[model samples]
Target: MMTHPSGLILPESRLSDLMREHPHTIPVFLRHHMVCVGCWMSKFDTVADAVWNYGLDMETFLRELNQSAQSIPPQGTD
Candidate 1:
């Protein structure tokens, strides 16, 4: 199993909850063309499962997810 970016996300983490908790990550999903962003299955699928189902590599996906998370400043920071 691969490590996720941080508390921001994890492979075993559910996609629906992640998006709801971290809206900033939407770009990462979009960049990868992950339909799970709006897919009903996102509620039940983990990032690991979703990536694999979408034919994506776990490490690469995590990398992009981390990068996108880092790019976005916190809600209070400017």
Candidate 2:
């Protein structure tokens, strides 16, 4: 399992917790056609489970997610 910079464990991080911590990730889930954004199961499912259920490439998907998270502008800069 990979670890997010915020210390959340990837693959094992509950989708709800992840989304709450990084709302930016919601778009990624949408782009991937993942309904986890609003699904109740998000509270119980982990990122890895989403990947497996969607048949996504783990390495690539995680890389994209990391990239998206990194793109968030530093606070107070505009």
The list of candidate 2 runs beyond 4 A from truth reads: 1-9, 73-78
Displacement of the residue 5 alpha carbon in candidate 2, Å:
5.1
Q: Model 1, 1-78: lDDT tens per residue?
A: 222445456788787767766678888888777787889778888888988888888888877776666676423311
RMSD of each: 4.7, 4.7
Which candidate tops TM-score? 2
After superposition, which runs of candidate 1 have C-alpha atoms over 4 Å from their true positions? Answer: 1-8, 73-78
Clashes by residue pair, model 1: none
Question: The CA-based lDDT of model 2 is what?
Answer: 0.74
* RMSD of model 2 against the true structure: 4.7
For 1-78, candidate 2 gives per-residue lDDT tens digits of: 234557434778778777766677779999988899989888888889999999999888887766775676323212
TM-score of 1: 0.75
